[model samples]
Target: MHAIIQSLCTLWRPSWQGMVMGELKYRRGGGSGGPYKVAASGRRIVRVSASSEAGERMDLLLFPAAGFAGGARAGEAGAPWHRFSADEVRRYSASLGDHNEIHQSERPIVSGFQIAEAMGALEGDRDFRIRFHYPIRSDEMVSLRKEGKAIYGVTDVLCFIWEAL
Candidate 1:
């Protein structure tokens, strides 16, 4: 099971260079139970658990509910803000062949991929595990905050988190 989990982690590791744009540094703690850590460009860190079951159980512990409060604020130091329009969302959705009605509505719903794209372009060099807390509408503003290896997206609320690979 440990080997299976390790293999899965290796396979799932992000290969998108544009998605994470920086040199990767690897560090292995000296113990069988130690988590593997990979840091990227001083902004992102990927933690691989020593075992599969432990890894699964660690998700909630890694990101707690209180972490989403206050979200990312615009104009903060080191936090960059971005905006997307309904037309941009539609075009992006069409480009990806995603024809979801929610994305085409009058108050078009912004796809998560769109948010990932913007985050990837601006942040670069990280694998992201984003949790969508709210649906972003067109013309809404989104701000990104990099707290260590975690990147939070604040779009009127805590919208998503991009965990670096």
Candidate 2:
């Protein structure tokens, strides 16, 4: 099952990359000028300079899930950790009227929008910029945390950082 899913994701990568590149082109004329620092919770702040390609790549890396393999343990200090099942992913995709193949796979990948929904449910509505590093499989556990102006998604395999809006 994992192999099949991996192959599908591999096949889907080029199209996703093209979409991102297209969006980047569209955004070229709109953003602010050089050297911006994004504040995260606690005392961490990340600096990005618009003048450098490295900074742009770093920014891309910063923004970008799951599972319950640990016997259903509770979140630390009453934190809200969401578990995404195949059914929940289906329902969420249906609710949004999105029929993306990735969201409909046997071990469907949870959408970033759905993660935002979970974040809002836990911490109220707020604007966020999210970057995904991996695909979350069904039955995966996800947790959200707020530090200053950032919200992070914690999963067994990867961590996602969201800039609070």
Measured by TM-score, the strongest candidate is: 1
* lDDT over C-alpha atoms for residue 50 of model 1: 27
**Residues 1-165, model 1: lDDT tens digits:** 122223323423333211211111111223333243322121133232323323321121112223334544333433547778888888876765554566777888676556655665676634445565655678877777788887766665766667655
TM-score to native of every candidate shown: 0.51, 0.50
Q: Give the TM-score of candidate 1.
A: 0.51
Could you give candidate 2's per-residue lDDT for residues 1-165 as a string of tens digits? 111112222222222321110000001222332232322121122122122222221122111111222322223422447779999987776666554566777888776556645654565543345655445667877766667776656665444556654
Clashing pairs in 2: 41-147, 41-148, 63-131, 64-131, 64-132, 67-140, 67-141
Error of 1 at 59 (Å): 16
Q: Report the poorest 10 consecutive residues by lDDT, candidate 1.
A: 17-26
After superposition, candidate 1 runs with Cα above 4 Å error: 1-80
User: Over all chains combined, what TM-score does candidate 2 have?
Assistant: 0.50
